[model samples]
Target chain A: MSAQTVADKVDRTDRLGIQQPRLPRLAPLGIAAGAAVLAVLIGVLGGLGSRIQWGLIAAILFVVGLYVISTVVEGGRQAKDRLATSLVWVAFLLAVVPLASLIWETVSKGIKVTDGYFLTHSMSGVVNVAPGGGVYHALMGTIEQVLIATVIATPIGLLTAVYLVEYGRGALAKAVTFFVDVMTGIPSIVAGLFVLSLWIMILDFGYSGFAGALALAILMMPVVVRSTEEMLKLVPNELREASYALGVPKWKTILKVVLPTSIGGITTGVMLAVARITGETAPVLLLVFGSPAINNNPFDGGQASLPLYIYQQWGAGTSASFDRAWAAALVLIVFVMILNLLARGIARWKAPKTGH
Target chain B: MAKRIDISGLTAYYGDFKAIEDISMAVEPRSVTAFIGPSGCGKSTFLRTINRMHEVIPGARVEGKVMLDDENLYGTGVDPVSVRRVVGMVFQRPNPFPTMSVYENVAAGLKLNGRYKKSELDDVVEKSLRGANLWNEVKDRLNRPGSGLSGGQQQRLCIARAIAVEPQVLLMDEPCSALDPISTLAIEDLIGDLKTRFTIVIVTHNMQQAARVSDRTAFFNLSAVGEPGRLIELDDTDKIFSNPSVQATEDYVSGRFG
Candidate 1:
């Protein structure tokens, strides 16, 4: 009945019967270290060329060793449980390894050429094969084009989502939903070609950042609609009913109550869409035609974006160009990272104050 | 302003299935009327028809007349939105607009009607909260989210929001069902005070609650499963509890059967 009695009863039972055994908390760590040593020795003797292979072998041996040792010390069920846990840990490391390596590779290769001078100056007179060029023009073009695309896409996407959630009915809603699904899977290159044919060839507009933006807007819209729709659906029907019972009209209820309630999620979705289109190179290459000199007016002439700049630099196939490409890639990743952080900040600031 | 309700042969349907059968009754102004019924008896559905809240659901329709004082609520040119302004409602569960502060939730209805100066809005919000017996509990935390309040407090906040607009009639569908006994008693006391200014209609599953808080009581019942719920009887609360005119009403009032 009491804590002392329960403990005495358990102690008496343990002394009278066989003891239940468990491995120490640090057992897995010790086993992992042993497995690593064994894997490295096997790799050396077997003449395996890559450390990646050694890591894979180590992960496998660790899981297998954990299962066998746990079975001997504990039981079959505990062994299976440990095996599952180790498998999940190995999978997590597998996922993390590529991402960590990518960031490491970008930082190491890009750090040499990514100074203030590289960010402030443009490649007006510099050739692609030389090492003096910068990414100033590409940064400006990406900022302008992505901003334009977001401005174009967000309202359209938001309204479409509202219609689907609030007032949609019958065949028309289904058709729109089907089309949006279809559009979400459209290849980025196909969007580029569509924009090039329509905006440039038929409309007789020259290659410009605006043309690239049109394609980016096409890609951003469906993602926004999907996420916004999901957020809207999450709003409880009771809130809407409460608003209606207070004599608020449907549109006013949606605008004042529903939209405000889900604004954080909607903003997050829009920011994610913006991030997706920011790194798009296919549309920029086909429509904007990639410029080396800075062009502030996106409507009139060709412009460069970071992704397109990276592609062009890499295509040059020179050591200097390769360095420039790596630096541009790093800059692009940092830009996206900043945007994501800003998105999170906005989400927190705008989130409904439901907690104490 | 309080207004009387006069219904005549009112029938409601959810798609092709009838929810409530043709029934008629009159509810006096400035009095509390409680509707008592078993589960699935359509008491809540009938209450929704007063403000045309019933038709808000897809394929849900109503037939016959609902007269609010001199105006027919189902008149050809009358808008449901305007009708709702005169007939506010409190739902079964407390829903206080999680995005809004307590002050904002109370002022939401007024904001919809028209623009108001800050001082005027503040006065109405205070008056409404006080009217719901919630001003003292929530006055200091007016700027906090309405959802942060206790369950009983949130329901009172919803009541404050409903009364802020000064509706003639206030319908409550089990407003105290989700609350504890103390909170239920608090709301019951508030109902006694509110009946002087608004025509109050409440649907309650608790028979003792109806006997305690209502001036008049109506009993609704269904003949069998899938049958449309029909009004069995309506009478003064004391008489209905002691000596009801209908056999079903007597059976229900005495707790012999539902």
Candidate 2:
């Protein structure tokens, strides 16, 4: 108690005065007032005559002022980091704002046109100058064609990936890998042309949805194979060893353990591939010739997908058709967005429950 | 019940490079045999060879005989998968299958073999987890992920997983090297209990642990450049610690050259 009393008596109260300099509290207010005065000056000088140019200049000045003020107070490093983060957010908003705005505009404007008759009836009997025709034929054709493409691409892509990752040995797998890399870079138009030449010259087959699907599959396979292969590789080798140690057959191990572990990623990748080929207009235009009415058969006639429907309508150059085209484009975008969301949801839902 | 594992002139190679050559030792029934050496001395490699797990590596191969009872493990047309079924391995780090629940991890091997009825699976999972001394702590959270368990418990879950397949021989490669002192003690206690039913072969860098848990110890070394690992000595644990037959073994045990 005596030592504590003596220590308390000797304690230096003046030594603990603030060491770091206090920040200027009036700085932000001063900067804001300066910005407001400059904006008013620019508005008065320009009035309503050159408002857009003046607004642009004012925006630039506002940004520069903010940068100067922040850096002056916060020091260079933190201010730069903050600026970088702000710029990233700005870029993200720039991309998202337009997309959101376009979607909102489309949904509001086209809801009236997006009815059952719009889905069921084609533009076969309706005149192009009028606004009665719907995208029913295009929607049906798109579904049947995309479904056929998925069926064709999914198995071959999955198997190729399995062989590359699991059983790939020596130079053969290397060769396959190299070729797949090359194929991945092939242009969409090139793919369409290749398919057109192959069917017309080699196979002598006429234009049909099946041929279009085959073309899309050519584009789709490399994507699925590459994504699925990477996903499969992510399944740890320890898991395979664990299965082997259990006396489980290799195939069963792949089916039960390996596939289940990677199924989430595989499904997501597959969905992405589906989304990619679903909007492919060049391949369908080249491979499948157009038919006016509903073509339920994929192997028989040229079926118009949503993209082709929009394309054909826009080419027709009538205001009514142009409206239909914009509306159809909106619908297609919504469909793709829904498919992406569905894929992501399914992946998360079915993902093997690994604990914390 | 424990079982004997005999190796006669066993040699292992990776491609053309011999990793371990002409090494022979026997793991006695119901006893622990420790393999101790410095890094890259092929102690773990030799342990892997005994269970035919060496072949899991792309180019690794073995010659000569590793016999369990009267069957030669290296005989022609022998499937390594069947060999692995009878001889389970625990790795240096705990890998309790991050995607599997605690109960599922214990029953992983059993479920892989066949579709078990729920009652049978529940019993087997419980019994194996109990055998590994992890049942009590995890019983309430059996549905939780195996990875959610503490490091020591995760290692124990891995042990439970290995035993769930009813393996006759258990090979542990520095199993407790990644654990803390208390966890190491827990594993050591579990090892002592496990030896009653399975032939135990362990590879360790820790001499104190070798002395503590092993009945017999084999010391390995690789001195000259470009030479395969050679066994320095193999003897009863008591003699190996107190009075070793080889100078290298004495030096290693007494904290000399590794």
Number of the predicted model whose lDDT against the real structure is largest: 1
Docking class of 2: medium
Task: Give lDDT tens digits, candidate 2, residues B76-122.
Answer: 88888888888888988887776678988888888877857868888
Question: What TM-score does chain B alone reach in each candidate, compared with the true chain B?
Answer: 0.98, 0.97
Against the true structure, candidate 1 has what lDDT? Answer: 0.95
lDDT score at residue B96, model 2, on the 0-100 scale: 71
Best by DockQ: 1
The 10-residue segment of model 2 chain A with minimum total lDDT is A14-23
Which residue ranges in model 2 land beyond 4 Å of their true spot? A1-71, A101-112, A200-204, B115-120, B224-227
DockQ of each: 0.76, 0.58
TM-score (chain B) for candidate 1 is: 0.98
Every candidate's CA RMSD: 2.3, 4.4
**lDDT tens digits, residues B1-258, model 1?**
899999999999999999999989999999999999889989999999999999989899999999998899999999999999999999999999988999999999999767577779999999999999999998998999999999999999999999999999999999999999999999999999999999999999999999999999999999988999999999999999999999889998888883
**Scoring model 1 with DockQ, what do you get?**
0.76
